[model samples]
Target chain A: MFPSGHPERSAVERNGVEGSRDQTLKVPQRYSSTPLRSVRNDEKVSRHSSLCGLALGLVLIACAIPSAKAQDFLDHVDEALSFSALNGEVRARVSGTLDLEVYHFSGLSPGLIRTTNDTLFNPRLSLFLDAQLGPSVYLFTQTRVDRGFDPSDRGAQLRLDEYAVRVTPWEDGRFTLQAGQFSTVVGNWVPRHLSWENPFVNAPLPYENVTAIGDKSAPYYSFLGIGTPAEKYEHNPIIWGPSYATGVSVAGKIGQFDYAGEIKNASLSSRPESWPITRMDFANPTVSGRVGFRPNEMWTFGFSASEGAYLRPEAMSTLPFGRDPGDYHERLFGQDIGFAWHHWQLWAEFFEARFEVPGFTDADTFAYYLEAKYKFTPQFFGAVRWNQQFFGDVTNSYGGTAPWGRDLWRADLAVGYRFTAHTQLKLQYSFQHEKDGGNDSDHIFAAQFTVRF
Target chain B: MRCLVFCLCLLSALTRSAPAQGSVEGQVDLPRTKSAPVMTKRYEIVTTGGVLGTNPPLAVVYLEGSFPTSSNLPTKQVAQKDLAFVPALLPVQVGTKVEFPNLEKDTYHNIFSYSPAKRFDLGRYRPDEKPVPSQIFDVAGLVTLRCDIHEHMRGLILVLATPHFVVTDDSGHFRLKGLPAGHYTLKAWIDSRTTREHPIDLKSGSTLQVDFPATP
Candidate 1:
């Protein structure tokens, strides 16, 4: 429901449908006359069911031909035929990185510190498949794989992420919905890296450490529960353009700015009976919103914020049928700012988080990164970065780190180069120090390669 | 009749070809990339910023310029190559003659323009062959150009009175030359999807450099 006298409606009405919404193609599917297409094959054993399946199959074939063409190719009749319509594109990317670090403790002098080097060269791969079903409906899917650190080594049963479905009912696609698993709409940087289309290597602290499930967290960091459940709604915006929201999202435009907000339930935890599996839930319902402005064709800006209580699975109880209680809540707040010129880019972000424990002191943390880049060539650029992290209230954890409350600091210097369109290489060196005034510091080094298709 | 022939001959002597067709060249500068270089046989670079390629030549380029728009109705024009339509952007006036020079060595080509503004199709013809003299664009507006055989070959016939446009070069530079002595609206188009416009007054031989910024 939209608020009365909301400023965005008029903006949408005036500016027409937003461009982003218009271009996004949906995934394709055969809508069977049987209605319930998900039924198992064994269920169609009866003669009546067999007849129904055959009739449904015939109807689907009739509907599928034209529908797929319209939806996928914007109703281009010439491209509707299998021989006439080429319905796929080859999307790929390649990227790499290097990280170096020097460690020092608060009590130890810089001379006594030694460097513990770590390097990574993981290749990222992706495949995006798109097809049109009709003038108003289409289908698309992107599957990705990575090779570097064994996810199972990191306690993950499966390493892959992202299998999503989207639908557009309207011809112009001003209003649309997306269903299926997708990247959490929590932050800008966590979903996709700058090298893939972003401007920086590290996400703002709030985004890097909060809600997102990956290596960018502390020993007690949160993981993506199972999936973000719910449908996302987006309306064409007027001025700044289209905005996206999920989990009961409201999107559209207001005057010269585009805005979006969503309220959704995130998984907190899950545990199996008679098994050692204790899945954590970040499944609590949370709210997030973003507003963007575009004054002219060249300049654009956006601001986003979110707050949610993430469930901690490690705190789960082994009880057999009793309800498990949620005992920890992490509050996140952050801001992002970015700008792009013809050949130059600037981005900076700051975030602060507070982890609330039922029986322990509240742990607070802050992280920030500032970076600027210039495109020396279409595929090459140089940049300087400053990144810092502060962790406070380190308690002891089973993983060998102080519990939720520990204090530490890190500073880094980085330079990056891109050799080809998708291939990139980055080298970074950072210095980290402990706060307790004791001498425990080590050096860190990392290198990574990312490829997308 | 003899006096009319003498007058026509004198007029023909005075007429000359449109200014030897000079080229407009420029470069596009992109911000440095942060990660390792992407390795591919050929990199298809696209950004919120934009990429450059001619509808006809199909050469890859980086560009920064005004986006083309259909707000102000212009005459429809079409460019054809092979059986494919080229230059995708065809800014012409109503009743303008669009020459379809067949660049393909073997196939026949047919050009068609279908839109609310104009609708007409030129029957097929072999290479080095000509379609009925020319198709007259009687309507003013955006027209979609297509070929019968090559489904991917598509272009727009932007019929207009003023030709205030330029395409970005390999380096992303564009310049509109030889403007009429008056104030006019300048618009740039990319892929017929994104467009930007501005009002400017130019001297007959002045060159203006307009830099289009990549969306952040």
Candidate 2:
């Protein structure tokens, strides 16, 4: 049901010349420049854990809501009973990986960086429940617990990643209603979780938070709506409907080609006096869509684009320094042209953003990356990626090395081996060069293993 | 009464041709209820006569070391009466003649095959006292017998391979006759459930007993 075979117009199969507006991977951050240590605290983890417990408990209570015991007993005595059955099943999985990073510098000999750091392994646990309540209804639930490993932190923690409930009133499966915290249907790449759906072992750099957006960061696949109400609309009854497309979504079909649109609330500004304070409002709704073709069982191709504003806490926070504390309300635009053929895949996306803060005659920044990957076999593959980023002067006035100034070019090569379907080990090396000066280049060697059950 | 008498004579003549292996004994096993939400109290058994006669009432059902796959039925004419197909259950050999006589004055009837195993729509027929030349079912399987024009008229034509077979009566018991001494496999296939199979060694005159479990 994702996309019917439109082989010729798949997401990856496109002949149109790339336009200026078509930009790629941009990681939107919740708070740019804000220290990561500040946001990741013990309190937040504990609070989230409690909330997960309550939500799961509530779902359990909701399941025990109906019964007709007296009628069943009487029917048994009278030999007039009619009944169905209820059955449940559960499955679990666990996997891990290791990654080491080395570096390659441009205009210099290729060598390993002296400050080589490594990520030993990361494990994830997931529980899925499939239940058939009666003749007509069924329920599916998945819970994930993850342990992230960093050389600095020896301890690990689990998080309730997602909770969803899907209801089917009709057995033929024409209609369904789903509620809970789930993935938003945005760009094909944004919504697909790295561990769950992607063929590549590591996510693209632009798909990360540090580069794409100033503040709020969402990994290529993260979205949650706390009781937000949304419904889908379609002119043709059978072709389109909103069941899971909410908070952020992608939907619609053109001829044999299928397109999905995503919408999410972005940060906006109030009065000039409230400069540093970031308010969660409908500054702009990030709207994006992907149109793709799937001709047969083997291939898929798609083109995607989105325009909106993202929230950057550090930029929005009022700092005492004379420097403009930047703002989370950054106008952003993006376009991604991608296609995957059979087991082998390739894609490239570019992103550009502009800011209209007070002192800077408005600043514009651009970033783009080209990523290509091939799956040599089901268990092994390799990837190569290149990224280019540019930044504008802070003020229009004669610039004396304006507020911030520098551009960066980065490239990475990686090879991964999947020890099992749920576990993979990847080794990647990254090289970066500063167009200006100051710690301009960094050689990062990384090894990571991801597991899910 | 005269017609009934003639049918009985035909049944006697047919049963006589085959060696009659008398009485049989068996039981229908119902699974342990355990903690099932609903307890079934009453059950009903529907039987059909073999190629020769009406499924006999209270027939002695025995367990041959193995289950007998075939049940025989006569090809004789079964007329329409009071808007119902007479002798609703007809068990016949894989190749046998079945006569359908039109006895209704006001209604026409058509015996058709809608079952996947055997498919054929025997066109409609006018009311006539004379019987039409029989339909020979070459395939061995259950054929759901129905009427093309009448929605309520329904019946069954069970085409079988072996001649040794019988349908249980109201008490859920059945029997087969004249099974020679040998090792055989007895299997029972029920709708909406898995089939049961048991190895059975049948003897010249001995009766074997077996039970089949029914789930609620």
Candidate 3:
């Protein structure tokens, strides 16, 4: 579901191109910056180009042949030409998916806010390239191109979502070491967050919400009981399980048990503003890991943990309240389970995080979500999800007006139809309720189409 | 002189009559469940009495130990259309070759197998493209064929060394004729399960009958 690597293509190419049967063509290297007169005078370049063109033409002719044997011969030629271009090495395989979504949101809150109702469109295109450099070494990169028509979001951008180099010292992939920017192995959903894989349009509370409240352009409203002063909102603690961080990870499987450990530059709460501008704090590294066991194909259970600094020492010192920067550590623990039987799939996760605040006592927050999907038929499926976040009472806070411990819950219902193996359409409706004086709530409806190739 | 003529005639008759050939006939009892009706109505199991048959044609009956003298067999083809394998199940000799051709237009297909008998991948290819060179089944075992892009597309290949084989008809009846009279270990395979071997001795010009119990 996470867009598994395709070793099949390489296997076929390897088998189809016999070593003794293929003839390698010598390709010439030409620099476009060279003078035009110099290029025209180069005999070797002209001959190489002509030979390559001739080979292409021959391949086309071979394909047009009606006989199966002749077509096979032409296929070999095409493969050989491609092989030669890659130096007889099939190093990389490429795959990608496209997802587009249209959604409308309506909110009811205590304050007089403009644009209580809004509609927007979001589109995301992702490409994955996995290169097997050697039998034991591999490189993988994922790039995402996105466009968001929201006033408060980044308009359009192309970002390198994940880039990692993995080294498998063992032959059977029982042990692996990966380095670079990659998804945090804290929970089950983040790794499978693609639109086609996820049953719902939006992520659960633990991954989507509970981030630094002040990071967005919008102002923080105490519609929920938990409130933070506008000046100190930047330090608000939220679980950042869905984000990717620059780090090195070690992962492998032993029988039915799988484990992954990561040492990242920053905690989930402190993800960089953007992937391109990521900056690591070498002195304060975050360690996160998950250990899971699949008793059988039908069920999987996992436990995850992370401990690191959520706020930078410099940023902690500039807080409005008298707080110590050294005491701001974030520790998180979680348990997750997945079950699949017949046409039904269920997944649930519970997360509890303890944050050490400078001016206040440690704030403990609990977040969890349960989701279930049933496939009435192979092509149609219906799903429902319930998610909530509860903030523990805060003590020794400088300001009593802050919504110290607010609670929020959301419910989602969705139905999806798969037109083909590579295409799907999903419609989802969700409602969010905040338990506070104002009882703020929001209604959201979304439709998404995803295609993979 | 009459006795000498008679002896010559007897010798000529013996030479003309080669080793006697026998036939093996059998009926396979397929396991049926009350739930089968629901599955059939859902189109999960086609009742076409062939590749996706519920009984009879679903099983492959063959003899072990004895083989044909010739090893040269023409290549066979399995095509992809309507998002399904033309023949969901195929049986061939150990050294036979199989070709998978995509017949759909403007679509891509990939064929692969991880069975220990034959592990290979044809990669993703377009329609009308040359099929991967015929896959040679050198090992005698079941090879599960699957499409990586389409999870539901599945096919099976049964490679055996013996040349005496037959697939049961709609009535669950099968007959293998023209087999040289001898002792043989008869086996029947249905889906992924195989029936116990029934050893039998065939007398000259005689018919042998064997039946396999239904499997759950």
Candidate 4:
């Protein structure tokens, strides 16, 4: 009963914005579009994003006065680019990176992407503003204007992915308080999730895989198989991208241990629009935290856990008469490890996620990814990531139970070259297939050119 | 014995040392840093266009003159420790071998340079490794060094053609000695992209003093 092109692939409908997460080692996010079948409110972010970009550009120009003699310009460009004032007590810098990518994938389906174009182009510009107000207080922010905000979606939009004020009361990052919108505290990949920082173009399976658990609708568990009914697959993801939900976090190090905890407005699976407090309040805030131990310079180990309401108020009407939206929750626990030795760097994360859905059995998924990158030279590097997801058993109406979502795996290979310290070009290839082996058209190839200022 | 003597004669061209006379001494007023230097971030646009140091040790002073090239120059050492390149600026005569030893326990350091004058890759290795790696700078130009594993780690190698050169001291004081009578250009370097040069005539057994204005 499947369509020829697997337009019913049922993956990544709203995941376009999922790729736009934050980009400073200071932090990260996931960006993607909403449902292909629905209208997007993000178009407004696109229309007004130009104004936002102009305003920011004006600030940069006002701060930097490089319009002088070539020698004078070169001599004081960096000084102008990163301005200092108040007798050097206050400093501010404006930096940005741009990515222009082209994608050629075997899978072409209306449900996953609505673009009828032959070659899919995704262009994104990430602007970062960092200010040091004082020795103890600092601010970091990133904004972007991109088509769909997600790589695969069609449309142009602008969004402020991250903004945080950090207060480090002491030295060596012992204890710090950070507030405003920031990357989730539940994982380790966010640090390298940016287009210029990350070795691969696509995020790991856990961040992008769209499970049959939409926050907008009540799930249906009485199913015989995965993807049998296409609509069921449009639900929610175990963890949507960097989950840049609005929150305040405390992250710091004590000896060899690093601890971080946050109270956020939305769950890990909430859509991008719900990330801001204006669209969604923190009535039922999600609390997430992580504890990390750096045994040595080469290795880091971490454990993270998160729990909160995953469903939105829009889903309230679809739930049981007596239950509210917050009645259901999403719980997750994960382990992450990182190793950097010589020219080789490795990172691995394993997570067990559970979503309490209404009118259905709880949806549980086991997801993990192992990625390794090796530098061939100072300017060149290659990387490979192995990602997999396994769904737990769900009680269907039939005599037997099936996995809530399909079990799938993907492998991504990439190589990148930095032409200069500020410019880079990367190429990537990925092969994704399901446990059922239904999606043979999931092979994807993409390339991106990035420039950072 | 005859062949060995012949090889020794050939090696003298590379081992030739400059005479201990004709010194050029000066003080460079380094541009004062406005604030405490931040840790290097890979994506950060280096605001201090200066090549030498993020914290101190102002500039590298070198001379360009007609001098025999040498492949047997003394080797210098740069260590990778605390996730940084020790002695961030290293000025050496062309053809001098520079050794980069990883000194951090558990961590590994892979030092490489993309400079056209001296392009080399010292494969990734840790201190636990048997031997520290080294590379020879055969060309006369600036070579920027970086650690592959750490984006924040940066180093600069100023490879000079002449033996008359000296790195500025912490107070931005430099004294380059042993130059023959000839017309030469005295250059002061901060980073690969930034440098100042002054043409001068050096007389045998004479001392010349010059100062570079503070330029950070």
TM-score for each model: 0.43, 0.41, 0.54, 0.77
CA lDDT, candidate 1, residue A438: 30
Report every candidate's CA lDDT: 0.37, 0.41, 0.60, 0.69
* Poorest lDDT segment (10 consecutive residues) of candidate 1 chain B: B41-50
Chain A vs native chain A, TM-score per candidate: 0.53, 0.52, 0.71, 0.80
Off by over 4 Å in 2: A1-123, A126-157, A163-184, A196-201, A209-213, A216-250, A266-286, A291-309, A312-328, A396-405, A419-423, A450-452, B1-216
Writing each residue's lDDT as its tens digit, candidate 3 over B97-148 gives 8988878643355676655678666755556555444588989988877674
lDDT of 1 at B58: 16
Which order, best to worst by TM-score? 4, 3, 1, 2
Which predicted model would earn the best lDDT?
4
Off by over 4 Å in 1: A1-117, A130-140, A147-160, A167-176, A190-195, A198-250, A263-283, A294-303, A312-314, A318-327, A391-412, A437-443, A449-453, B1-216
**Every model's DockQ:** 0.03, 0.02, 0.03, 0.15
The positional error of residue A106 in candidate 3, measured at the CA in angstroms, is 1.5
Task: Name the lDDT value of residue B100 in candidate 3.
Answer: 87
Chain B only: TM-score of model 3: 0.77
A169-203, model 4: which lDDT tens digit per residue?
Answer: 77566677878887787778887878877998778
| Candidate ordering by lDDT (highest first) | 4, 3, 2, 1
Question: What are the fnat scores of the candidates, in the order listed?
Answer: 0.01, 0.00, 0.00, 0.16
Which of the numbered candidates is closest to the native, going by highest TM-score?
Answer: 4
lDDT of 2 at A78: 24
